[model samples]
Target: MPRGAVRVDLNISLDGYATTTDQTPENPFGHDWGRLVGAYTATRTFRARVLGDTSGAGTTGVDEAYAEAYFEEVGAEIMGAGMFGLHDHGDDPDWRGWWGENPPFHVPVFVLTHTPHPTLEMEGGTTFRFVDTDIEHALELAHEAAGGKDVRIGGGPTTVRQFLAAGLVDRLHVAIAPILLGRGIRLWDDLRGLEAGYDVVAETADSGTIHLTFRRE
Candidate 1:
């Protein structure tokens, strides 16, 4: 069978920031993070995965539809070390991750970092393998472990920008929140005229978040 799609999903601010500068140990996602991902967090899928809430207490409309699409056919995930809490927990050898014992991703998750760490096996099928390799090599490893399913590039802006620059991403879905972060990691920085290569489509959810999908043409 052919290899699966390489996808990237991110929640960015109106000003194109994927994160804010106010991130700290206590506030891992920072001040604007919550607002940026409010639509997604209010979805049933996120509540189920992150909060372990199967009581079905989230929105079931447009936002939830996109949230459901995020987990469909994903067999592997690649993320930046910052997303895995390596920037904060780099020195701590016992720091598992931001997610407790059972992470949402039940597939092999490759964490890109400069300092390689041992493979961490969590409660679920989520195994975090720290790698110091380049993007191509990391994708190769992830593809091999995907078992013919789609590979997701779970990001922190910089990592997603790297893959975007390398022309490695096949599809990208971004949820643009109405907030303006002013100064954080900008997703569109140095990516001038980047949309020319993709067949783009946009939709607005009832919660006011704009969903944009880009598929390489």
Candidate 2:
């Protein structure tokens, strides 16, 4: 049997920003975050998986195709502290996650942070495990939890960048939303000449979202 591959998928803007700074108390995710991930969320796959809308609605084109692949063959996921809402509500012991009763990721999700928290088991097969260890150790734990399936590096850009910089990712996929955010966390900041390590491919969707994929050669 083959071991699982470490993969990552993210949504970015044309200006290379992966996150925005317009977050407020009422709108925690920021308004632009929706615009950034608008295309993927509009897909039928996202509707069925995340929103539980099995009405057979939504587009089934390139965007949907990538959305479908996002959940394929993955048994475990690793995310950053920010991705788990720890940065905002770390003190709230009752704060589970942004996903509510049940998160879309049914697999085990390991959250990397400087602090540790108790494991949270949700309604579905999802289990949230906090890791205060390093990136490589987190991947090791995720791989074990995956049970032979692929391990996904699901993130908030910073975590993804660290993993990519350490040459830990086997596949990196980014959906470039056709908008320019002037200020935010940029994905390709210090990682110059990243293409030399991976075979890259790009595909444009009907929504004008360009899907860029980089696979280690």
Candidate 3:
């Protein structure tokens, strides 16, 4: 079988910003975070997988289709320290993550951080492994843990940008929310003409969010 592909799923604003500076100690995610991923989190797939809501209470349209694809065929995940809630909770050694006891990822999760922490095996099949190394080494470990399934480059924007800059990503999916967040980390800052080698597709969801998918040629 072919080695699983490297993928990234992210939510950005109309201006291409992926992060905001308004995040306070009280609200780690900041105020505009929800607006960015509102359409995505409202999908049935997200409700069932992330929110653990099985009552079938969410949209099942274009956005849902991408949301469903996000979880499918992913065997291992790689995320930044902030994505794992490390930037804010680093002081707390027992702080598992933002997802509580059982995270949504039911696979090996490689967290890119500077510190060396013990492997945290969570409730589901998910196990958190911190990699205090380069991106290539992290990808190697993730691919090994994936066991032939796809390796996901889970985001915090900066992490995703690194993979994209290194040209290691196979498939890139971004849900473009309509909200205008004037101040934040822009996703397309220096990565101009990134759509050159990829087959791109754009679809507007019922919720006005545009889903853009880029598959390497």
Candidate 4:
């Protein structure tokens, strides 16, 4: 079996923000969160995986291609506490995740957080394991759990930045939406000249979102 790859996929705004601070229970992405990932949400893959819509009422172009690629060959997922609903759940022991019952990720998900929570086993083969460790240890555990398949770095920006800064990311995909989020968590701060270590490519889809791929050189 081929070795697993460390990959990350993110939807960022034109101003390079991955999330807004105005997140509410109703509006998870905050003020302009939808605008950043509207294209992705309308993809066929997203509809099928997230909404469980089998009617195929979604687009099938470049955006859909990227959306499909996001799940390709992925066997395990690593995410931050924020991405796993820690910020919203706080100390709620019953909070499983924002994704009810069956989550879109049908694999083992290792959540990085300081708060230790019991392992959660949900429907569709999704298991949530919380770890309070560094990026190296987290990746080691995720890689082991990956079982020789690709490991996806699911994000809310902060976690991805930490992995990238630590040079543990092998491949990165970022979709840049055509909007400016003046206030939010920026993804490219203090990471100047970060593209030098990767073979980069950029494509602009019809939805006006630029999809960027960075493969380690």
Candidate 5:
């Protein structure tokens, strides 16, 4: 038993795009994907532990339960450089992360990047360590950081595709929103040659989102 379990939690459109065309400020995605993520992150227990806030009092049952499962079982996090944004460059060497002063992840976060950068120590015991190596190296570091817990693969599509192509991901949890993004970024772009099989372990629907969990089979 390693320190962590690799899991990917992401939101996609009905068309399978994780992001819409023109992600810039001028042409933001028309869908309310941010709202959906906000709702998911606002779970009472999740917010309390991750954000150090107790304002998320009225979270629904399913959302709270899902958040608990994600956060409680996670010991470390892995993400692509894109998901972490362009913090690697620019003048701010110690930019920490995009999650402002305190990121949601309270454990070690292994960021996959090409350039080498120093580890960022944020509030709430979150350390953002950049990894320029391949997926296998990143997974090994994440598992080491997890310390017998599970490693979560936070994504920006490309990173998830790499892991999937390498046959490294054990489980995937995708929240499908009821919208269509003509084109932007897709999750299954490079999965054509992989021998991955999935079993639908659970499925649920909310106001505007359908949650689907798959276990590698």
Candidate 6:
């Protein structure tokens, strides 16, 4: 039997916006706001486990702690096509991969997309597989590839909403930033009237973000 779990990890403004209205290349976020995600992505454990690099060590105590807690058990990842850039118009057919030279997810990554694309093999052990079926199909594929380890649901709000609304997500990790974007993508927008509920499993706050974990009840 394949052992895996799905969890959402994202940073959002206090007013609830993952990215600003103009989600173009010029302004990824609105108004140069919020803390840089680089710091969170630079953790030693995060680098080693996700990026397949040997460098990096515990810098900030909190950062190191969160890295250890979140990344220790991940074996696979599932993401939305928007997060993987499948909807982006580009000449290169292989332009869907998230990280350029080296992506952070070293394990199998199942990307949810409407169009069927070939599987992408990147440096290290990461392979981005496009799933044109549905969120449940992607989860099943992720679980099959994960062996006995956990499967992380890398999000773009819409994808997370699909899973949450279906009651398929087992866990969620939300990092609420202190800044506010006023308008953009929202985490709870699509899940407004869902009959699902999440029980708080853990909560923590830092200078830039507040981390919260939830388990379906």
Residue lDDT tens for model 3, 19-76? 8777888998788988898898899999988878989999998999999898889989
RMSD of each: 1.6, 1.4, 1.7, 1.7, 2.9, 3.2
TM-score of 3: 0.93
Model 4, span 157-178: residue lDDT tens: 8889988888888999999999
TM-score of 4: 0.93
For residues 1-217, write the lDDT of model 6, one tens digit per residue.
Answer: 8576677777677776666564457776534343535446666776777666776653555655776778667889988888887666434675745577568787899988777788888877789988878777778888889887888888877788788888887787676766666777777776765434777754554555667677767
The better candidate by TM-score, 2 or 4, is 2
Candidate 6: residue 52 Cα off by (Å)? 9.0
| Best candidate according to TM-score | 2
The true-versus-predicted C-alpha distance at residue 187 of model 3, in Å, is 1.2
True-structure Cα RMSD, model 4: 1.7
- The parts of candidate 2 lying over 4 Å away from their true place are 25-28
Give residue 116's error in model 3 in angstroms: 0.9
- The residue ranges of model 5 lying beyond 4 angstroms of the native Cα positions read 1-3, 21-31, 35-56, 87-91, 193-196
How many pairs collide in each candidate, listed in order? 0, 0, 0, 0, 5, 1
lDDT of each: 0.92, 0.92, 0.91, 0.89, 0.75, 0.72
> Per-residue lDDT tens digits of candidate 2, residues 122-174?
98888999989999999999999999999999988999999998899999999
Model 5, poorest ten-residue lDDT window?
27-36
* TM-scores for every candidate against the unseen true structure: 0.94, 0.95, 0.93, 0.93, 0.84, 0.82
lDDT of 1: 0.92
- Stronger candidate by lDDT (4 vs 6): 4
Better of 3 and 4 by lDDT: 3
